[model samples]
Target: ERFRQVIWPGNSTTVPKGWEIPTNGKKLIVGVPMKKGFFDFVEVKRRSINNAETILSGYSIDVFEAALKKLPYSVIPKYVYLKSPVNYD
Candidate 1:
């Protein structure tokens, strides 16, 4: 027999009998824009010695992290630094 569980936000903390919690191992890739104007929103910096080392921070990242905490399932976010001076056109 297959069992399913439904978790409502702020409803209850107890798990129902015979219900199994779902697990996801896949990671979600998130792109952060590299802009020169607004450093408060998002900022991406690479080390001079090792280009592979990236440092990400700012207000936008904080907001995104807060939203992720509200989700019922766990999500792993892989941040990718986008090219600077991005043009939509």
Candidate 2:
């Protein structure tokens, strides 16, 4: 019963705004910091000789991927490498 509501959310007015899924085909972008130290937490590597291919791995990434797998809907994520000295503020 609950699954039906998720698949076909009737009465769009009753549903709260801001939770709508994007219709356009776009993958979610995830920014991962490129750290000089602490590679265990998160590590970004380039496999190709020309540095065209990139790989992301580590404990943090593993946990994130696990969580994504549990979600009811599919969420494609593109991990981008963020240079060090990232400023949140």
Candidate 3:
């Protein structure tokens, strides 16, 4: 049920306004805090993800790394591959 709500958010996959997560729930909650990821395709929604894999993109990554170095590492998105569009969707 949770998987259907996120990850593949097509039409009808939505959350109502002003709702909050349960504080005392026993079930595991995998949280992805990307605000863009919640509403649309995370790729098209976030240009930074595309820029990360392109030429001359290291500078941005460096700044982010420098700021977060003290924090623990988490699963992060890396822009490794890019494909041009053949036809507009």
Best by lDDT: 2
- Clash tally, candidates in order: 0, 0, 0
RMSD of 3: 15.3
- Residue-pair clash count for candidate 3: 0
User: Where is model 2 poorest over a 10-residue stretch in terms of lDDT?
Assistant: 1-10
Q: Is candidate 2 or candidate 3 better by lDDT?
A: 2
- CA lDDT of 13 in candidate 3? 48
State the lDDT at 68 in candidate 2.
82
lDDT of 2 by residue, 1-89 (tens): 35454433564635545324656778889989986888999899999999999988899999999998787677778887788965656
**lDDT of candidates 1 onward, in order:** 0.74, 0.79, 0.38
Rate residue 6 of model 1 by lDDT: 65
lDDT tens digits by residue: candidate 3, 1-89: 35443533345446533214434443333222232222332332234755543232334445554665544433233333334434434
lDDT per residue for candidate 1 within 8-58, as digits (tens), equals 555755763421333555577998877687888888888768687888888
Clashing pairs in 1: none
RMSD list, candidates in order: 8.6, 7.0, 15.3
